[model samples]
Every structure is written in structure tokens, then in C-alpha cells.
Target chain A: MMLNLFHLTVLSFISSLKEETLPVAEFVNKSVKWITEKFSWFFDPIKNDFGDKLEDFADMLAEIPPSIVIVLVVLIAFFITGKKFGLATFSLVGLLFIYNQQLWEELMLTFTLVLVASLISVIVGIPVGILMSKSNLAENIIKPILDFMQTMPAFVYLIPAVAFFGIGMVPGVFASFIFATPPVVRFTNLGIRQVSKELVEASDAFGTTGSQKLFKVELPMAKTTIMAGVNQTVMLSLSMVVIASMIGAPGLGREVLSALQRANAGTGFVAGLGIVILAIIIDRITQNLNKESA
Target chain B: MPVIKVNNLSKIFGKKTKEAQKLLDEGLKKEEILEKTGCTVGVNRASFEVEEGEVFVIMGLSGSGKSTLVRLLNRLIEPTEGDVEIDNENLAKMNKDDLRKVRREKMSMVFQKFALFPFKTVLENTEFGLEVQGINKEERSKKAKEALELVGLGSFIEQYPSQLSGGMQQRVGLARALANDPEVLLMDEAFSALDPLIRKDMQDELLDLQEKMQKTIIFITHDLDEALRIGDRIALMKDGSIVQIGSPEEILINPANDYVEKFVEDVDRSKVLTAENIMKRPETVDIDKHGPRVALERIREQGLSSIYVVDRSRNLKGYVTADDVSDAKKQEKKDLKEILRTDMPTVEKDTSIQEIFDIIHDASVPVAVVEDGKLRGIIVRGAVIAALANGNEVNGDDA
Candidate 1:
């Protein structure tokens, strides 16, 4: 009887202040709307011009002969992976299969997106990671921001990203940039921090300046770890491709999205297969690079 | 002036150092301070000075702050209190730029872990100090190669640090430090990671190098034997406080307290007992004036199997057994030199009993303690054994 009374009291308490009374959803909607309205001036040039440039870059990559691209990538695979013909053959066959499926142009565009996104992550994430490793204040502040970037459902970033950059590959990149950057930053911080303390002392004992120590001792020692981070960034960016297509980004992801819309299992399966092949090839190449450097 | 002077250097690892410092100044013990403020007293107001060209050793057990104390000299671990002065300039108070200048131009350190850059080849790792100093590539490479050659790693320069053994890796670390050609070399337990035999070899190599270059070296080691072997003076630390500081002989013969007495008690006396301390006055027949008959008579009277034969100037010639001298006298061989065994081993006065143990162990005759080509004293097998069994009692036998 007492438990039932307590339950009824709690239920009445929640019912007393319910629904839009919280104003959380309405508040978020207004904030996003306000940001979009105010930032249209800033977002316009980036959306129009940067969007055109990214598409042109993707188109330029697509224009390359599939066979030539295949041979070049296979050659890179062969050389970097200790000349393993097995890996070289796998890349050769994987690219040929994607080409055979008529997803060559889409694959090229996806490649461009992942490539640029990963490049941006490395360029921005490494210095931030280095900063985090060097300073506890930076680590304390940036760490939570990174956690927010990583753990919040990747879909949530799309709302802000679109508000700032608008629809297409530009926002796709912005979304991927948010989602994929944490691993690189986190890994970079961890890598640099993991450098042997004695080595650090040896460097300092010789009186190395900040940049000298970073470039000469810390970075070189942390290379494998940082590279591992970069690899993770690239993989995460690849994972973001299909989700990015919801924003009208052009890639194999768009083909998969269209296939889903038409309810054509065959077409969707083929496009998904193309993505899987691409993911495998990229993953192997990055992993091989890691082993070779180490 | 001393090359490196450290004054009341203290390092307290804690957030509440102000309170810990207050407690420290109030003369609270390290444990008391830790209980009060939760701070680890890494080095507690340790003070010492290292003279130019002297091997000033800082030695203690692990966590005794020997490592912390050494790091303070180069300002690797900033001091919580007091100051370290290199030459006349205060290292603890200097700005970052000036402190860096002192580090780059005045001092270099070799680590216990042989912290060479793994990605770099031996040549690259060795030149790292000079490289960071902004020396030109050509100049730095040349110096690095020479340093590697000095450490006997010239052939291994093209290889990576991972390719070398522990001993050779430390040689690269030594080379890296030497490449900068700094005036002061700080070695923090540099050979503590090596095999015992290799550690001994490295110690000897360092001694040889120090003698030639005379760089003021601050060597840190937990091994008392190592400190005794290489140190011109030793500072013994306990609970981050320097309990005593003195020459090795002084430290060994007159340890400041029971802590030191117990520490030195475990050191192998053979390594510390030199031939000079154990040698007795030799009973010899002068080959310049005495015949083999006189040598035999002296050997018989002394109730000894063998006797050393020295010249009128007391220059060591050789030794003669009583059987040989008697045989020579009976054969009408007049000269003691004719019966003398010149193959008997001779050791220098400063040669440790450890070095003479093997020769004395199987010897048919007593070993001559020769110095400057003159017969200084004699060392028999029993004397070496006696020195090993009893620490400093052999010094009394010099009479």
C-alpha cells in the first residue's frame, strides 16, 4: 500500500510539469534557427565557392583513367608493404571490381572526401594533440570537447554543421571533421605522452628548445602512435560517408542512398560492396604503412 | 671555482609545496612532511660542489634522491627550493634562455636507460645534442663521428640504436653526450642496466676517457662498488639528504654512521683493496752482490720456498726458489741471477687485489709489487686472501 502511494505521488509530480513546459526542444530549435539566420552571410561564400571547389576536385579525380589509378595505387601498395604481391593483387582486384560495378566515379568522389577530411584532421589534430600532451590546462579543457565530439551520436553534429555550412560535401566534410578528428587528437596526445621519460630528460638535459624537442625527440618517438591515430581518422571518415550522403554529398554513399530510395536490393548491395572493398583496401594500406615505419 | 655548485637543492613533488616547504624549513623529517602535506621529498636541501675535472659521485639506494639531485644540477627537474650555480651564474634563477644556453654549451647527460632515438641511426642519435645546439650539419656530423669513435662505436654508427647491445647503446649515449663537447658530463646511473662484466668494462673505459679528457663529471650510481671505483669524491644520500661527503678512502675507512657502515660492509673488499695496502716488505737477495748460495741461505733462514732477487739499486730483477738456488750452488753456478725465475708476475702498487687474485691463486712465488721499475713491496697469496676476508685490516700489515 505504501509503495503504491509513493508511485502515485511521483507520477502526479512528473505530470504536474510535463510536455513543452521543459522548452528544451523548442529552445534548441530556436537556437539553431537563430544561428542559421545570423550566420547566413558567413556560410554563403563557404557553401557556394568551397562546395564548387570540392566538387571540381572530386570531378578531376574521377576524370583520371580508372586503369591508371588502379595501377598507381597498386604500385603504392606493393612498394610500401614490403613489396607484398598479395596486397598488391588485392588492391588491383578490389579496384577492378568497383570499376566493373559502374561505381568508379562514385568511388573517386568518396576517395576525395575521405582523403581531404583525413588530411584536415591530421593537419589540425596533431598540433592540438601536441598541445594537449605538453600542457595539462589544454588537456583538461580540450579533452571534454573531444569527448563531446566523439560520444554524442555523430548525427547531432549534422544539425550545427548544416546550419553553418549548408547542404552538400561542404557540410559532409564539416560533419566528418567533427566525428573523425577525436581519434587523431586523442591518439596524438597519448603517443607524445607515452614517450619514455628518460628520453625526454636526455633531450632537456642537452638544453633542447620547445620546437627542437618536439620535432627531434618527442614526435619521432611518437610517430607510430600518431600514424595509428591518422589511420583511425581516415577509417572513421570512411564510416561517415553513407551518413554524409543524407546531406546531398556526392559519392558511393549517394548511389547507396538512391538504391535504398528505389527499393532496389541489387543496386544497393552492389554499391555497399564497392564501399566495403574500398574500406578494406584503405585499411590494409594504412596498417601496412604503420608496420613499415615501426 | 667548482665547475658545478649545488646549494641546498630540494625537489618536493606535490601540489601543496608551499606548505611542504614551510614544513621542510621547520626541520620536519621527510616522513613528517609527507604526513602533514602529502608531498614526496625527492631531494631535501642537498648541497654539494663538483670541482673541475673531478668525478664527483652521488650515490645511494633507489629512491634516495640521487637521481633527483643529479637532475637538479642541469635543471631537468626544477628545484622546489635553493639554487644550482654553474660556474658563477645561478642556474636555478636564470631565465629559460640563459638556462638553456648553460645546458647546450656547458653540460650534457648520459642516462641509465641509454635513451637514444630509436628511429635514428647511431650517427644521427650521437649528433642529436650538437644538432639541437643548431650546429651546422657537417660540423655536427663530424663531431658525432669522432665521439662515436672515442666511445669505440665508430663501426656501428650507421646502425640504429635498437641494433646495438645494451653496452654499445650506452656507448652511443656516451657518444651523444660527448659530441656536444660540453665541459660537464652528468652520468645518472649510466651503467646500472648492463651486465656485471659489461658494467665493469664500461667503468674502466670511462676512467680511461676521464683521465685523458678530465671533463668534470657528476656520476650518479646506487652501486657502492661503482662509486668507489670511479669517484674522486662521493656524497652519500639518505631520505633525500646528503648524509656524508668525502673521498672514497675516507668514506670507506671512516663512514659517517651505521647506514654508511652497513652500506660499505657489503662491497667486495678485493675490488677496494689495492696491492699497496696489502704488500709486505720483501726479503730478497741482492743479485748484484750475492751468489746463488747466499740466496739459498736467506731462503732457508726465512723458512720460505722462494725469494725475490733485487739489484743494489733495489730494482726488481726476478725471484728464485730455494731448490733452484741450492741446485745452482751445488752445480757451481755462482750467480743468483742464473737461478732466478724472471717469469714471476709483477703488479703495480695501485693494482687492486681483484686484478692480482688469478695470478696469486696459482702462483709458485709471491707477486712483486713493482712501482716505477723499483721493488716497492711483495704480495703473496695469503695476503690477498686475508685482504678479501677482512676489509681494511690488510692496511695494518704494511709494517
Candidate 2:
């Protein structure tokens, strides 16, 4: 009897709120059409300019000879983080291994994607975070939006991104950018908010202007935390590479995706191994930089 | 003229400050005003003048508005209602730029927490004010180094604040303020966070620096002893209002109410009352006057065992005991100088009564309160005991 009642209640509820009667798809389509038709000028320039820049950077990274790139990376690792010979050697060996696997160009493409996405994320995130830190109203409004962006499935964003940017590297970047921005923003806000009240009072007492206090005291002190956020953004960007490749973004992700479809276990293993090595190299370099700054 | 003058300064810490201020003007107490308007009165109609080169102390318990008053003096915390004039220029009317300029040029502050920028080296912190003033690097660095040396932190200039001890960090904080060469200094519980020994040392160091710098200073503290030890005059706050303002001795001898009396009840009067506060007029005979016979006559007339012997210019030569005077008279001594005992215990007018205990313990004659080479007054053992026993009732006759 109870089961029959439950079924009846469900039937009534479903009949009252029929899926076909809902205007969700129609509303979304109309909004999308209107945005594209009316505001294409606004978005198209950004999409074209940013997309071209990303592709150019990726091509540059890919065209560089493997040996020269390896030399540069090792020198950078050694010089920026003095006495890190072990890290430099590891980076060198890791790059050589990726080259041996014949995945050098794919690695470079993945590197470029992560670099560009992380750069965009940091550029946009810091000021937003600072705004969030400064105003409770901004923080309250932005927090849930950030949560929505972070929590929404990466694939769900990809659909809309492809609709706006078409299936290509730009849409892939747009998707990855949505997926990776929250950490930097959240961390920057947290870092600034966590500055000791006494220190802020001291700054005010010394007659520091608002901007001077931010640049001289707050930002410098919050550097480690903000860098941690940057590190997270980079990793998140890397994680989106495989997903981004489904939209024809070229990288180790493409290699892995093609290998998955072809059922080529060896190719998949090699591509996956290449990705891990690349991730390790980037992670170690950033972690070392953070430690040095600290 | 006073370097800093505050008139009717009040700060209410809530949105209903205007309402609370109205209640305050109508003579509502802090708690009553809070009940009426949900506003916490941080400072209530505080008014005081700080003379140039004076260490004017503001003292109260944790919530009594002492800190708020000091911050208001610098306009660090904007007052709800008041006029603060620094060197006769009204700070309340200054614009942002002018206020910043005043902060950089006329007034500097040291915090209780030492408020050193954690990321900055001691040298960098010391140079902060000068940097804000846009001084050239070479000149600012030279000035900063001098200030650091003045605070005895010259050696740790290269170290970050976290590397230093609390007291040392506070000294760096002081150096940071001093480096600005500000005409006035506001110290907010600057040594309250230190160990007792370190706090005493800092207090002494501040007094020493005060001697050399002679800047107008407004010092905030919760410790009464500290207020008495360092302040030229002290204003005691209670429930967001100043209840009393006087020198330490005046506060001790004549508290304004029962609250102040109870506040000072446990204080060691011997430490707070100085020779200047307790000294009395002394009977004396001039050394170059007549002879030992005259000295004997003066002692006998005063019914005293001994009399201080001063030259005609009132410069204390020494003292002569009645026995020595008689011995001189019997020997027919022509000069009273021969009988004068130059070894009598003497103290400066600024010396604390606690310091005179040992000097007065075995002395037959009263301790001469001297400033430079001349005698100002004398301190007797009985007077010290009377002042210590009943701090408020101490009168001129007892001293």
C-alpha cells in the first residue's frame, strides 16, 4: 500500500513538472544564440587574440630543439635555485627520457597549455582575491561563484566552451581555465586576510597609504601562500590536459586519448609515463622556487 | 607651550556614535550609554596638554581608554568628537595628505607588540618613516643608523625582527620611531609585553633617551608603577574618562576619589615619592659668617643636634654637629669651616625615597637634598617613614 502511494505521488509530481514542458534547453539555446549574435564582437576578439597567442607560444616551445630546451631548463633550475644540481640533473634526464619516448613535441604542447592557463588564472585571480580580502560583500558574492566554477564537472564546461569557441585549442583552454582558477583566487584571499591585525594597525599608524600597505606589507608577506596557490593552479591546469585533448588540443593528452581509442597499451603506457615525468619536472621546479622565496 | 593639546576628545566604537555621544553629553556613564545605544565608548571627552620634552603618561586598566586616547592624539583612531592640536595646528581638520605629512614629520609611535614588519630587516624597519617621507637613500640610511645606535641596536640592524628577542624587537620599534626625528612621540603600551626585568630596563633606557632627545612624549600604560616611574605628569582614566591628572607624587598624596585611592593603596610610596616631593626646609648657618660659637647658637636655637653649613652664596659647604661646634668653641676656633663635617649624606632632589633609606639609616644629620652644588631641602628619616606609612596624609611639616 505504501509503495503504491509513493508511486502515485511520484506520478503526480512528474506529471505536474513534465520535462518536455520545462524551457531549460530553449532558454539556454536562446541565451547562447543572443550572446553569439549580439556580443560576438566582444568575445570574438578575445577568443581570436588569446587563442593565437596560445598557439604561437605552444609552437615556439615545440619548435625549440630538445637538447637546447633541456640545457635551458637545467641552467634555469641551477641558477634560480643555486646549488640544486640534483634537481637540474633530474630535469635534464627527465626531458631526455620524454625525447627518447618521441613525445617531446607533445610534452612541449602540454607545457605551453599549462603555462598559458596558469598565467591567465594568476593574472585574473590575484586582484579578485585582493578585492575579496578587502570587502566582505565582494567575498560573499564571489565565494559561491568560485565554488560553482570549481565544483562543476570539467566536461560540462567543455560543452559550453566548445559551443562558444568551437572544438579546438581555444575551447580546450577556456575549459581548463574555468577548471583551474579557483585555487589561486582562494589562496590569495586567504593569505591577505591572514595578515596579523597588529601589523595592519602598525602600517596604518605609520601613515602608509592603502596601496603602499598592500604592495609593501601585505603582498610580500602573503607571497608564500599566493605562490602555493599558483602551484595548485599549475597542477590543476596540467590535470585538465587530457580532458582538453578530447577537443583536439594537441599534447601528451592527445597521444593518450588516441592510444585509449586504438587499444594500444604500449603507446598509452609511454604517453602516461611521459606526462608523469613532465608533471614531476614542473612540480619540482615550482616547489623549489617557493622554498627559495620562503 | 604644550606640544600636543587634546580638547573634549571622545571615541565611541559603533554606528550609533552620534546617539551615544549625545547620551555622553547628557552625563550618561559608559555602561549606561552602552545600554542606551549599543555603542562602546572607547574614549570619553578626554582633554589634556602635553608639554614639550615632557613624558605625559596615560594610565588605566585594559578597557579604560588609555590606548584609545594615545591613538587619538596621533589621529590613528579618529575621534568621535574632539579637537587635537599638534603644535597649535588642528589634527582633526587635516586632510589625508596633511595627516600623513604630520605623521611622517611631527609624530611617530611605538607599539606594545613591537609591530616590526616581519619581512623587513631592522635597518629597513628603522628607515621606514624616512622612506615614507621620500628621503634620499644615503641620508635616510645614515639617519636610521644613528637612531639604531641610539637605541643600542646598531649590531642587529641586518637581522629580521623575528630573529630578535621581544625586548630587542621593541628597541627596534623605538629606533624606527626615533629615526624619523619627530617632534612628538606616542608610545602605546610599548614595554607591556616584555618580561619584568626587560620592561624595567626599557623604562630606564627610555628615560635615558628622553634626557638626550627631549621630545614631547605621550606614553600609555596599564601599570601604575611604570606611569609613576617615567611620567612627568600622569592622567588616570576610568571607564573611558580621565579621573585624575597630576604628577605621580600628587596622585599618590591626593587621589581624586575612592577609586583612585584604592588604585594607589598598594603602591610602594618610597619608590614613587622622590626627594623633591618629600624634602623640607633645612636650618642652616653660613660657614663664613661668625665662628663655631654662632653655629652652636643656631643649632641650640633650632633645638637641633646638627645644622647644615652653607657659604654666603647658599652653596652647601657641609654640616656641623653641636658637639663639634662646642669643641670648636672651647678650642676658640676662628673658622667654623674646620668643624664642618663635609661627609654628611647628601641626595639629589630627584632621588627616590627608597634610595635614601641606606644613606639616612646610620646618619645623625638629615640627608641634604642637593641639586648641582646648592642645597634645596633636606630629607629626614622620620619624614620618609611618615610618607611611607600614610601616603595621602603626608604634609609639609612631616617632611
Candidate 3:
């Protein structure tokens, strides 16, 4: 009897709101299609320009022989981090391990994707974050928008990204950018806001202009925090590669996706290990950059 | 002439400043004005003038608007109402570019926290003011080096501010201000963060610098002892308004109201009151005119056992005791010089009362207040005791 009553309530609720009558999904689809049709000229140029540059960069990374790439990364690790031999050796061994798996080209492509996505996120995110820090109006408006971008499921954004940029590396880059951008923006704003009040007052007392204070005092003091933001962006972008490969992006992510389809556990495990190695190398390098600046 | 003149200056910090200003003009108290307009009155109608070469101090407890008042002098914190004139030019009327120029050239500030840029070396910090003025690199560095030498920080120029002690960092802060060779220096509690010994040393260093440079200084501090020690003149503030403005002696002797009296109640009077403050005109015998008989008569008339003998120019030759005058009279001496006691206690007019205690303790007569051999006044033992016991009473009626 109790089960019958529950079923009756569910039936009544279901009858009141039909999916076709709601029309929310359809409205969103139609608006997206109309906007694309009307504004393709505006978006197409930007998309083409970014797509060409990104592809060229990826090709450049691929053109380098695996041995030369490993040595170059090892040298960079040593020089940029104040001659830390441990870090340099670790980077060399890590790259060699990835190379041994015969996944070198796939790792390079994944590296390029993460690099481009992180770069775009930083370039767009920093100034917006600065703007947010400087004005209360910008902070109030951007804060909720950043919250939505960060909290909404990463998969949900891929749909709109595909509608706008189509299914290719560009859409994958676009999707990864959307997923990775919030941290850099949030940390930039937080970093600038955390600058000591006394330091700001001192700069003003010395007659510094608004721009001079921002560059000379605020940015230098906020270097570590902003670098932390960049590190987070890199990691987030790396995490999104597999999810992004569902839309035709190529990389270790594509290998993992193929392995999943074939139900091949060994292939999937090796690709996953490669991704982990890449993440650790990049993370250590960025953290060392942060420490050196500090 | 005044180097800086602040006229009817007021600063209300909050969004409702306009309404707060109206309430202020309507004669509302700070609390009442805040309640009516939801604004904090940082400074309220403060008016004062800082003379050239004078150490003008603005002193108050925390949240009394003394810090705000100094910032307003250089327009670091804009005033809601009023005008500050540096030389003859009105600061309130100047545009942003002109204000910056003034800050760069005419005024420099030393912060309470020794606001040296943490990333900058001592030399770089010292060069900040000159760099802001667009001076050439070579010239600015030379000037910065000179300024650092002036503050005794030349050896530490290569070190970062974090590497220096609090006193050393504050010296770098001072050097930074001096590097501009500004006409006015605004120091906001420049030594309050230092240890007591270091604070005293810094005060003496500032005095030494003042003696050589003679630059006009406007210093802010919450400590009364610091103010008394350094200020040529002090303005005391309470609840965002200046309650009194006077020399340290004037403030101590005649506090304006109950608030000021309470503020100064714990002060050690002997350190503040000088011989000039407690001295009086002395009974004297002239060396050029008065003979032994006249000297003895004058001493007896004044009911004293001795009298100071001065030459025709009032040059304090010495003091003559009554017994010595009588002996001179019995011997029919023509020269009063022989009767003169040149070893009698003598002190400068500016000597503090504390120094006078030892001088008067063993003296047979009043101590002569002398300056460059001229007799200024005389300090008696009784006067010092009376002044100490009734310290606040001296200037009680003046307020």
C-alpha cells in the first residue's frame, strides 16, 4: 500500500513536466546555433589563427629527436633551478623512462597541448585577475562567474566548446583552457590582494604612479603565489587531456582512450604511467622556479 | 616664515564623507558625526604652522589621527576639506602631477614600519626618492651614497633591508628621505619600533643631523617622551582634533585641559623643566660701580648672605658673600674684585633641573644662570624644590 502511494506521487510529478514542454535544452541549442551562424566571421579568424599557431608549436616539439629533447630538458632543469643536480638527474631519468615505453611522440603531443592551454589560461587570466583585484565591481562580478566555471562539470563545457570550435585539437585546447583557467585568475587576485598594506602605503608615500606600484611592488611581492597559480593551471590542463581526447585530440590521452575501447589493461597502465612522469617533471620545475624567485 | 601651513584640514574616511563633512561643519562631535553619517573622522579641522628648521611633532595615542595628519601634509592621504601650503603654493589646489613633483622634490617621508622595499638593497632603497624624480642614474647613486653616509649606513648599502637590524633599516629609511635633499621631511613615528637604547641613539642622530642640515621636519609619534625629547614645538591630538599646540615645556607646564593634564601626569618634571624656566632675577652688586659698603648693604637688604657681582657689561664676574663684603669694608678695600667668589656655582640657562640638583646641593648661594659670561638669571635651591613639587602649577593658569 505504501509503495502504491509512492508510485502515485511519482506518476503525478512526472506528468506535470515533460522534457519537450520544458524546452530548456532546445532553447540553448537553437541560440547557440543562431549565434554561431551570425558571428562565425568574428570567431573564425581567431579560431584559425590560434589553431595554426598551436599546430605549428606542436609540430616543432615533435620534430626534435627524442635524445636531443631529453638532454635539452635536463639542461633546463639544471640551469633554471640553481644547479640542483638531483632535480636535473631526476628529470633525465624520468624522460628516459617515458622514452623507453615508445610513447615519446605521444608524450610530446600531450606536453604541447598542456603547454598551449596553460599559456592561454595565464595570458587571459592574469589581467582579468588584476582587474578583479583593483576594482570592487569587477571582483563582485567575476567572483561568481569564476565559481561557476570552476564548479560546473568539466564535461559540460566540452559540448559548447565543440559547438563553437568543432571537434579537433582546437576544441580540446578550448575545453582544457576553460577547465584550467580559474585557479590562475583566483590566485592572481588573491596574491595581489594579500600584498601588505604598509608596503602599498610606502609606495604611495614615495610618489609612485598607479602602474609603477603595480609592476614594481605588487607583482614582485606576489611572484610566488602567481607561480603557484601557474603550477595548478599546468596540472589541471594535464588532467583534462584524456577527457579532451574524446573529441579527437591526439596524445597519450588518445592511447589511453584506445586502450579502454580494446579493454587492454597493460596498454592503459603504461600510458597512465607516462602521464604521471610528465606531471611530476613539470611540477618540480615550476616549484623550483617559485623557490628561486622567493 | 612658516615652511608648512595646514589650515582647517579634515579627513573623513568612509563612503559617506560628504554627509560627515556636513555634520562636522554643524559642530557635531566625532562619535556623533560617525553615528549620523557612518563615517570615521580621521582628522578634524586641524590647523598649525611648522616653522623652517623646526622639528614640529604631532603626537597622539593610537587612532588619534596623528598619522593621518602627517600623511595629509604630503597629500599621501587626501583631506576631505582644507588646504596645506608648502612654501606659498597651496597643496589642495595642485593637480596630481604637481603633487607628485612636490612629493619628489619638496617633501620626503620616513614610515613608522621602516617601509624599506623588501626586495631592494639599502642603496636601492636610498635611491628611491631620487629615482622617482627622474634624476640620472650616476647622479642619483652619488646622492644616495652620500645620504647613506650621512645616516651611518654606508657599509650596509649592498645588504637587503631584511638583513639589517630595526635601527639600521630605519637609518636606511632616513637615508632614503635625505637622498632627495628635500626642503621638508615627514617622519611618521620613525623610531617607535626600535629598542629604547636604539631609539635614544636615533634621536641624538636626528638632532645631530638637524644641527648640520637645518631642514624643516614634521614628525609624528604616539610616545610623549619621544615628542618631548625631539620636538621644537608639538601639537597634541585627541579624538581627531588637536587639543593643544606648544613647545614641549609649554605643553608640560600648561596643559590645555583635563585630557592633557592626565596625559602629562606621569612625566618626570626634572628632565623637562630647565634652569631658564625656574630661574628669577637675582640681587646683584656691580663690580664697576659698587664698593664693599654698598655690596654689604645690598646683600643685607635682600635678606641674603651673598650677591652676584657683574662688570659694567653685566658680565658675571663672581658672587660676593656678606662676610667677605664686611671684611672688605673693614679693610677699606677699593677693588670689589678681591671679595668676589669666582668659584660659586654657575649653570647655563638651558641646563635641566636634574643637573641643577648637584650644583645647588653644596652651594652657599643661588646658582648664576650664565650664557657666554653674561648673567641671565639666578637659580636658588628653594625654587628647584618648589618647581618640582608643584610642577603642573607653574602653567596651570595659562591654559
Highest DockQ against the true fold, candidate = 1
lDDT of 2 by residue, B1-399 (tens): 988889999999999999999988898888898888899999989888989999999999999989888888878788889899998999987899988888888889999998889889999999988887778999999999999999999898899999999999999999999999999989999999999999999999999999999999989999999999899999999989999999887899899999899989989888888888778888888777768888888888989999898888889999888998898899988898777678889999878878888789998889998888998888888888888898787766655
Name the weakest run of 10 consecutive residues (lDDT summed) in model 1 chain B: B390-399
lDDT tens string, model 3, B1-399? 998999999999999998898888888888897788889999999999989999999999999999999989888788999999999899977999888888888998998899888888899889987777678999999999999999998898899999999999999999999999999999999999999999999999999999999999999998899899999999999989999999999998889999998888877888888988888887787888889999989888878988899988899998888898899899999889886778888899889999998899998888898999899888878888877887776531221
By summed lDDT, the worst window of 10 consecutive residues in model 2 chain B runs over B390-399
> In model 3, what is the error at residue B177, expressed in angstroms?
1.4
lDDT of 2 at A171: 79
Rate residue B63 of model 3 by lDDT.
Answer: 92
Compute DockQ for each candidate against the true complex. Answer: 0.67, 0.53, 0.61
Q: Which stretches of candidate 3 lie over 4 Å from their true place?
A: A1-23, A46-49, B22-27, B326-338, B394-399
RMSD score of candidate 1 (Å): 5.9
Question: Cα miss at A99, model 3 (Å)?
Answer: 1.6
Among the numbered candidates, top lDDT falls to: 1
The DockQ score of candidate 3 comes to 0.61
Name the candidate, 2 or 3, with the larger TM-score value: 3
What TM-score fits each model?
0.85, 0.88, 0.93
Q: In CAPRI terms, where does candidate 3 land?
A: medium
